[model samples]
Target: MVVLATKCYVEGDARSRALDGMGSMLDDDLGELSVEWTVGVRDDDFVSVTVEGEDATVARNLLRERWGEIPTDGRLTAGETYTGTLESWDDEGFVLDAGTRVRVPTSELGLGPGSPSQIRDRFGLVQHLPLRFVAGDADEPARLADAERDRLYEWSRGAGRVNVNSATRGEVRATVNRAGHAGDIVTVERLGLLEQSIVCAEGTDPPGLLASIGGYLPAELKCVIP
Candidate 1:
């Protein structure tokens, strides 16, 4: 069993739809392999997959590479990198929901000049968005991973973006088309199963794109203005 880093926090019919979507994704990813698999949401809301068959090992590795894995042992080894979903933030730091909650201090964020909330807003970070971090132990402290920092910094240098949560990539793309702003976006990048980033085309305003499509999503939307 491998616990995935993405969350399936929605309930009711929405939850069923999300799981159905997940199943389809699993089929696309593992069908070629001689494996049987089942997907479930754990108590913590993180998605978990159980696989077995001739090619189970290969399929498991592919899943881990595609969606970062949560350590089943529930332990973080010092200096190792891990992925977690952004849960909440405070004046002091940001709390990431891995298999467990990992608190990353503001001083350790490495993102320039802002409170944790400010940083989250400026970068258009949405709840449940997957982020990578380096684990810390007694002698040292945990911090955002260098690769994660580089990725967020690159977002600022791009042609702006509208980040969203609680919607699938397909849903977001459809919403853009429905809003008549399909030409405004470069692509809808999947940040997780339910989180997506709409990269704006040149001269397309990210905030304007957000306003046009936000009403259709029933999801949280924020912009990264370049």
Candidate 2:
């Protein structure tokens, strides 16, 4: 399953209200699945968001197609999509694609309204951590740490910096925690945050390690990756 986080901005009172109403438009297009809605007020402006299911690609496509139809107080602006990969799963629901990360919604898939867990699981996240930054030195430990922390999973000799096509924020976070490093150092990569990478970590055994950390981190300490 894929999770997508999309935001939009609009102008005008009527348009703002219309934009708020537009959150439900996806339900009409994607059927009656559970969605979580949040509205934010910034001075005279308003921002509204609808978090749907774990299928980010589908949700992104739907939002891209329907954003214009929403009415708003001001001009409507579409926000970027934050995509998460599936990491693990059980009888409840699937974890995010990033790694041992679990996302248990209130409603079941293809069912009613959904609820998101406040804590994100960290399994399978280590391999996805960035190994280098685009402009930073390749050998410096700080630079290397930044790269790894930023979700750059793959690096080419001549291409400078390349993102790990399969890496996800969740996976990298879990991996960092498992390595006994500060997981908070890992952050979402700007470019691939919305798309999945084709590159994957070299090993297969690490996934189990990530899952174990996911179960342990939430209880051991405030393992937050900000």
Candidate 3:
């Protein structure tokens, strides 16, 4: 069983829909392998996959590589990198839901020149977005992974983007099309199962794109303005 690092926090029908969507996705990811898999959500909302078949080992590693995994043992070693979902943020820092709450201080964010909230806003970080972070040693502090920092910085340097949560990648794409701004976006990048980033086309305005599609998606949207 590989506990996926991304979460499934929606409730009721939304939750079912999310899991069903993931099931379909799993078919795409592990279909070629000779394995049968079951998907379930943990008590704390992290997703888990149980695979059984001749190719189970290969399937497990593929799943772990595709979606980061939470250690079943619940132990995080210092100096190792892990992926977590963005749970909340404050003046002090950001809290990631990685089986446990991994608190990353603003001083350790390394994204530059902003409060945690400010940095979140600038980067268009939506709630429940998956983020990669490096664990702290005894004398150090937890921080965003260098690769994560580079990714966020690259977003700001791009054409612009509108990050969103609470909607599937397909849903985001449909919303953009329904909003009559399909041409405004280059693509809807899937950040996680339910989190997406709409990469704007050159000359497209991130805020304007958000406004156009906001009404269509029952989700949170933030802009990464270049």
Candidate 4:
């Protein structure tokens, strides 16, 4: 069994569509392998896969490489590294869906001194971005990983881009293409189970691109400026 690090946080028909899409993606990912697998969606924003057959181990590793290993409860001891889908945030802190919800308080955000919202905006950290954090113990709150910090800083240095949340990679790509600005993006970087970062083409402003394509996607879109 392997728990994948993506979230399906929509509801009703949207929820069904998201689940079906995720199941299809898993099948496609493992289609060529000699393994039989079934996927289950967890309430806590994870996709669990149970694989059988002689090639199960290989399938497990392949899935692990594609989606970072889900941090099991036993691994949450203080100072251990884990990956999670960024859930939501407020003045207090940000919540990560690490199979279970893990809170990273404002003080432990590691993105410098500011309100959580301001820090997120300043750094372009969108919802559902796969964030790495160290598990905390007792009264301590989990803190963002140094590498994750470095990565956000790198994005801040690059050309500005448009970020989208609550949609899968394919959905975001299709929306972008339908917006008639297909030539305006460099690439669509998958940030989580549903979040995507559309890197802008040269001389393309993120805000303009967002304005152009925002109407087509049923997702929260934000502009990240360098």
Provide the clashing-pair count of each candidate structure. Answer: 0, 39, 0, 0
User: How do the residues 1-226 of candidate 1 rate in per-residue lDDT, one tens digit apiece?
Assistant: 9999999988887788788889999999999999999999899999999999999999999999999999988999999999999999999989998888899999999999999999999999998999999998888888999999999999999999999999878888899999999888899999998999999999998888888888888898989988
Against the unseen true structure, what C-alpha lDDT does each candidate score? 0.92, 0.31, 0.91, 0.81
TM-score of every model versus the real structure = 0.97, 0.20, 0.97, 0.87
* Per-residue lDDT value at 103 in model 2: 43
Which sections of candidate 4 miss by over 4 Å? 71-75
As for candidate 4, its clashing pairs are none
lDDT accuracy of residue 92 in candidate 2: 57
Clash count, candidate 1? 0
Ranking by lDDT: 1, 3, 4, 2
Best by lDDT: 1
Better of 1 and 4 by TM-score: 1
Candidate 4 has what TM-score?
0.87
Cα deviation at 104, candidate 2, in Å, is 19
Cα lDDT tens digits, model 3, 95-200, are 9987778889999999889898899999999999989999886788889999999999999999999999888888888889989998888999989988999999
